[model samples]
Target: MIPKINGLGRSFAGVAAYCLHDAPTPDERSPETSERVAWTDTRNLATIRAERAARLMAATAKAAPDLKRLAGGSRGGRKLAKPVLHYSLSWARDETPDRREMSRAVDGSLEALGLDGHEALVVAHEDTRHPHVHVVANRVDPETGKAATLGNSKLRLSRWAEGYEREQGRIRCEERVKNNERRRAGQELVRTPWERPRHWARVRRERMVPGRARRARGPRDEERVDMEAWRRVEAEAWETVADGRWRSLRHLETRAREEWVELHRRQEEMRQRLDRESRTVLGRLRIWRTERSLRELAGAIRGRQDLVEGWREDLDGYHRDERAELGKAHGERAREIERGWHKFYRSRLVEAERRAWAVRETMKERQETRERERGPSIIIPIPRPRQPRGPERGGGGFER
Candidate 1:
């Protein structure tokens, strides 16, 4: 099935245009485009120029979005512009025309075209080609957004085509050719290329033509002449039809080639798209990684700051404790010095009193000895007590 691309994004605007019933992702590039739009029946051998292809695709997209599905295959719910489907059929290679061979070719082409639906409607009838059939279907769908649909179906188109050929001087050879015919006598037979391939031109031919008479009369002079004339007309018509058929086949071959080119273009685009998307994702990832790394670095820095702040606070506390202990020790040393001074002063005062008492006792003893000899009232002239000496400067005995 043709992979869908609904609305164009990126470089996809007109690239997804045409889709054959057997077409792969009509909107996408074919294997021929990039070794990726697979060719089912025939290998896509050539490529169309990029510019031309883009233009044709643009036209197709504009004409119809669901062109591929409208042609036949069921494409679910995706609303797309119908793509224009143009095709013509010819022999595979070195093949020619015969009734049986022609029928088989036509049948094969129909199958190859892959008519899952569509191809049923026809307004006229045509018949042509003795051993081959030529089909022309305009890819335009009116009822839907798809290209033209063939509404009348196979049996209907085939019969109509036979009638169409008869009108064009090319006779219908199919067994069931009357169904789509205008049967009324007054009604004129319409020769349309939709059913049969024919060349329309004004030419004078004898009544003895193949189409002029369906059955031949008995063997007689008049019958013989008419038969001969009829044979001649049939020959001429075949030549004209053959020429026309050849041209049409060539045209179809060209269209097929164009389609191959279109497929190739899309394939290349697909590869590019995939590459582009991958690169975009990588770029975004790189940016995200860089940003994440920056964020982590910032967080680590903030944590370190907190640790330093705590250390600073601890150091201040330690200094304050040291100062308090040192101050206490200093006060204790001052008190000990005061105590030592007070003790030294008290000892000096006590020593002075003891010396004074000893002096008194010595004096009393002398007086007692004197009394034993004489009266105890001996006048002892103990010089008055000298004053305690202190630090003095030198001074002469005489008043100077």
Candidate 2:
């Protein structure tokens, strides 16, 4: 089994829509092979989304309030961030695990990630030859209102998968086995160059082109500029600024300016080195030579160019990974700051509500006291004296 854990996402509804409905194309959707493995609740997509949203809201509402004052106003509650964890498990092309096995694998993987009991929607897709199941789980625990710790989650899942493969008596993946061994020995997991998706794509494309076509294409100069290196430096700078040791955000900004200056200095140094190397290599190539010497020099230049390109690509990949890690760290730090602001706002809101309630109670008590102090006053009805009736119409002159 090959387990691919995707990135942490924000929108539960969006993910649910994609996994349950949007995953299969129209032709594949007619068969309706999507199965809800572990969702005990209603199967309606809208209902599931609403329930999950409500659960997330409840969890966030119950989070403990932090009273620390921050410069920015609290807006974190306006949107949910990184609550969705989507991943998939695929079997070998020849091996088709039954639904029961797939369910077990899903549960096992979730358990490995410390999210077994969390709300998860598992959907099996039969659109491809290889049977695979996609799992979308909420990272936030509904009960405790705490996000599950995801430290070394990839390694943990890989270990679980390895054991699972052994139990199934399947051919073990050598790469995964080596990675597990490395993990056990406290060594960093190393990925081969081709393991990079983009690098692999480039390799595959190159392989597809005919040799004649490739030769005709000639050698095109790749931009020697390393953008990934600059991105890595910038990401590292932000991460450094976001570190907890800083007295305040303002102080962090000041430190960031210093890092920025240092980055520019390094950039200048790199530019000068590139210039010197380019001039030296070009100057040597410009010298006239015999046809044999020319051919030999051409071959040498090509070999050196290939070596340099390979080195550059490898370095770029390393820098890309570094930037990604730094970016993730910076995001976590930013989320922490946002959460602090959120808690602070929640605490302030609660205090305001309490004060308002106390004021209302005080007003009610004063009204009651005033009513009690003023006793009721009695009023007797007073009748006015009746006027003498006017003389009858017929006997006006006579006294009746």
Candidate 3:
């Protein structure tokens, strides 16, 4: 359990009203648990608002008249003593503390802080995922006429939590708490505990607004950048420039033209093979009259050899013709591919430069702004007065 302590409520009446009053919208199924409330008999916001504040003031006066004296003037040790002490005791979501155990723990914790004699109200709120109780106590002791210093109160509460856990068989010890704290501080040897789901949601919310909320890790003004990822992108861009891949618009265009020529060479090779096969098929059709005749023994002997010879000759001629035809066709295709690749490569390279330039400019502006905020440097010019020239006098100063 973690205890959050605060000095709240400028006046006794203000504190009393806050403690007794129910939330504006009450939960019928899971109502708040209230205890030790003197002024307001019932947990109703309307009833508390109508007549509780004045009654609470009277109650406080009867309990601690010295506190009233302290409030009327600045005679108390504090320049302005806080009239009420407000705090909350919250447990992990898995721990379901019963009413009796919670009350005992709350009483023990309050006594440990030296507020046992004062009037207090403990209200358990069931709305949150984690079960917690809020304790509001009058800081002033009627007999002593002074408020107790709540220094190192968290340590006291921690001891109380450990005792409560042992007596109730909760098994959470001081050692475990210390280990958890060490793990949260980034100790490698200690294993981090799995946090409740609500913790992650709270973290995400804090990052979105940033600096608006307090976190256990301390203050963060903004989201931290992944410097490694940033450096990777920067290095890649510079490497491309250094390798002469995208040094200039003309250089990128030249690389694109090279790729286009290679693509055309592959297409021409495929076209030559396809044209030769078509010519061989046409030549075979003229020599072979019918499938039945080719299958006949004498017909096959007379025509098969002639058919094979004719097709071979025709395929060789087609290969030569296709080589000439493809040379012309590839020239046009290469130009088209070159134009498309040039436009694409140029746009991409320009985008990369713009992104890198933007990052550099942002960093420069931040540095300059920091220098401006630090104010100008002071350069002190020490005066070195020249020595006065005088007529030499052995025993008396010269008059000029």
How do all models score by TM-score? 0.19, 0.40, 0.35
TM-score of 3: 0.35
Over 268-387, each residue of candidate 2 has an lDDT whose tens digit, in order, gives 565455445434545324321322355447543544655344434654566557545644554455345545544544444344444445555666789889988886767998999775
lDDT of 1 by residue, 1-400 (tens): 0011122221212222222112345575443332221221211112233223434434444545455457674545444444433333332222234445444444443443443232311111112221112232223332243543333234333553454445445553543444334422222235555533321210011111123222222223332233444344444444554454345444543453354445445545644543443345453344335446554343334444443344345544554465445434433433343344335434433433344344445566777877788855658788986754434333533444
Write down the RMSD of candidate 2 (Cα, Å). 27.1
- Scored by lDDT, model 3 comes in at 0.53
List candidate 2 segments past 4 Å from native: 24-80, 188-190, 193-400
Candidate 3 lDDT by residue in tens digits, 253-322: 3443465455446555655654443355443343344333444334334445555555457655675576
Q: List the candidate numbers ranked by lDDT, top first.
A: 2, 3, 1
Candidate 3's C-alpha runs over 4 A off are 11-79, 92-96, 173-176, 179-400
Please count the clashing residue pairs in each candidate, in the order shown. Answer: 42, 0, 0
Relative to the true structure, how large is the alpha-carbon lDDT of every model? 0.37, 0.56, 0.53
* Best candidate, TM-score: 2
User: Which of candidates 2 and 3 is the stronger one according to lDDT?
Assistant: 2
**lDDT score, candidate 3, position 26:** 44
